[model samples]
Target: MTTFSITSDNLFMVSLLFLIGLLMPTLQIAGGQSIGVCYGDHGNDLPPAQEVIDLYKSQNIGRMRLYYENPGALQALRGSNIEVLLDVTNDKLQELNDPSAANSWVQNNIINYWPDVRFRYIAVGNEVIPGGSAQYVLPAMQNIQSAIVSAGLQDQIKVSTSVSTVVLGNPYPPSQGSFSGDALTYLQPIVQFLVSNGAPLLANVYPYFSYVGNTNSISLQYALFTSPSIVVMDGQFQYQNLFDAIMDALYSALEMVGAPNVEIVVSESGWPSAGGTVETIDNAQTYNANLIRHVAQGTPRRSGRAIETYVFAMFNENQKDPGIEQNFGLFYPNKQPVYTINFPQ
Candidate 1:
């Protein structure tokens, strides 16, 4: 009694949904099951570590990005069940190049808290590439990996570094993305190492900076994911938001480096609520809320898989340099939400 024909669009939709189903199971293990928030304790007036953990539990936030091995924070995180993306601060990168130092660092910070603290990834350095500290990144990562293997935790935790979008030479049009010559020298081997170890590249993607840099060309609606229609068409892929376009660009860059399979984890992304251009409570809430919902849909280039992301950050840091840097937090230093944001469980 019923007859139907599957069009190309229908087939594509079916394929996408099937791929999504396959990816759903891996989300939790990969830290993509729910949105994560970066917990930066740079302000003197911030709450105690235990109170912060309690806040996270109350909000249903499933993951956290810790900037370093803060003894107090690590102690508070025990048995909390919140997956953590721990960072190896830039200052410690060169020191970690020594295998013994790396092992000791891991033994003290990670091994000491094992089973109680769920560590997902150990980012060797944050946005240190394309700078003077670039040379030490790969070595530190190698040493850390060796340490992790020695501790019998190699399979449980991944080692990588957080990089900025500045590493991209040509990022526009998404499909034509490629790493800059300067950055490739530092990133090539790192990419290979990540591919071999099955670790994702941590990237700090900030569409806010891109939009503000060139407001005439980049629209706010596109950056905020409020666009009603497709904004950019790159070959067969259609991009409706800047976040997906930027992510696809990174994906394309990885492909150019002969490591197309290397996955990307958004280590930091957020909008400021004040102290900058177009920074307002409404805009910040819109951007973050939309980002949490959109990451689950994945990017066009890497369709049907959730993109693990960490919003930067939990509280506004008064200690940070004045301006937008201090205003990216989702909550105030007093522990009150700067604006209401819902995190899906």
Candidate 2:
């Protein structure tokens, strides 16, 4: 048998090899799962960040999306295998619009954590344009990206904003979809930024919202990702569920604007477990489980190119508004799953 002794020059190589060994298994598992979860901490009763991280690991959850740069949450995520998307909340958009402020925020929230946290993106502002924070969204995004560049972390972290499905106009035909109303002006520039930066368009697509808005027309089965009685026809495509329909519409809208190469990341999408006329444990499970399986297979129009998706929530948020707002969690406040769902290992 041959034995090797460690030397000063080989120490860094050994450490790197050990770190890679530790992370490779986890990285492979996460890569296979593809699906991610949104960690919304609005529930007073929700467990601490450490416990939440534990739950994620136990479930083999590889990706997580945070609503803000919460220190405690980021700390808990440190050295974990899960990849994260950190946010700059809508209210903070104005503050981060300035290059100096954005740099400060990056140093304080992201760079400060570094490789330990595995932060992949800085979601500049959540649903800002439609919510009237349009003026600040693009500026904040640019500033933050500039900050990342300044910090020498641009290659490791990307920047983009999460937008609502409401930004689209007449999204039915998919191919005919385009940004409408006041959104067009803001979207044109935003998409340009995304294209220039080679970042994805972060979209929060909710078939639930579409169904809620038109209950009489939108079938519950379609929203739930179950067997729909009627299949929606859009050009050469046949949509069995509403998720793909909404996604294709966004794709079409991007193509129309000459930003066809810009990819989309479904930043948030899930079914509520309660607080709605149709919301139920079974329905939530069905929608989410089917989503996991569906996203594994890319949209028909964009065959073989699976769109990365993150489910809306990890736990039921009690602090959210009454009705359907607080019930989109996959787990309870205790960190237990609301229902069983598989993440392919």
Candidate 3:
């Protein structure tokens, strides 16, 4: 029977070692650009949670962002060393308005399966800007973040909300990005909060949407990121494609409000393969293929930063809206690539 002495020095050493252990994984994530796929299951017909995870591994995806806190998905991804970013639904936004509910939300959903599940980011809600239901999103965001801090998880798990490109008033020129006049009212305070708290501004950008909506106006090659185009320039800064255009839209908006250094991450961006896109299956293949390669081989744009991107989904969700965008999956439901995509090669 050996009873070790408990002293301040011993406790301090233990705490330091624990922190270092925690930082080891963070270092790995920051080692290079990391990519993720959106794991939206608005469909009951998709594979079981665990099987879906296996499918993710089969495709060599290392990171994913889920739309809910369903335990089954968390349970499956727990020991996989994959990063899980969870979202609290817009309807549940009001829950965060109450401290107790917010605390419980983080405890039950976030902290409950922490280190084991590799939950890195808790997306407060999805696309808080455009949705009518997300009107209560600003205050709700504050409350959820308060919960994150209360649970002592803020340092480890980040809190953020995704915004659609609709938030941008002028997204094309990149240098001229601005939040829409209507959305600016709600977004100002939200952006201020995020800036104060060090959360990434997530933009759900889709060139397919831009092109499909304005087919006669824009070129397919530009949307695919493969064609050479004139950079929309403000003096010397040149943005090439929709990706950079959308990002700079937000960047310019943020800079207008004086929070220039706040990090902006592409929470969602992708090209659909299976159906309903004018961009040809070959274009989808080539576009998505090159997009992954470019993202993997990330480099600084004129602003001196490496771009962050997440291709839409791992599998084609049949239960999703029958529209073409709903079919925006890189792989078929059978768990195989829709086309050849060079990942980091």
Candidate number of the best lDDT: 1
Ranking by TM-score: 1, 2, 3
By lDDT: ranked, best first: 1, 2, 3
lDDT tens readout by residue for model 2, 1-345: 011111122111101011122212111222346788999998889998999999888888889999887889889999887899898888898887788998899899988888788888889888776556788889989999988888888888889988887788657566677887778888899999989988999998888777677655566666666643335665678777778878888899999889989999999888888886678776677677677767767776787788799998899999998867788888889777777665655
List clashing residue pairs in candidate 3.
Answer: none
Best by TM-score: 1
Provide the clash count, candidate 1.
0
Candidate 2 ranges with C-alpha deviation above 4 Å:
1-32, 228-230
lDDT of each: 0.83, 0.78, 0.66
- TM values, all candidates: 0.90, 0.88, 0.84
Model 1: per-residue lDDT, tens digit, 1-345? 011111112111101011122122112222236579999988988999999999998877989999999999999999999999999999999999898999999999999999799999999999887899999999999999999999888899999999988888888778988888998999999999999999999999888887777665666777787766777877999987788988898899999999999989999999998987688766787778778878888899888888889998999999988887789898887778888775646
Candidate 3 lDDT, 164-241, residue by residue in tens: 777776654556667778778877887888788888777777776776665445555556664454534444665455
Q: CA lDDT of 73 in candidate 3?
A: 92
Considering only N, C-alpha and C atoms within 3 Å, which residue pairs clash in candidate 2?
79-116
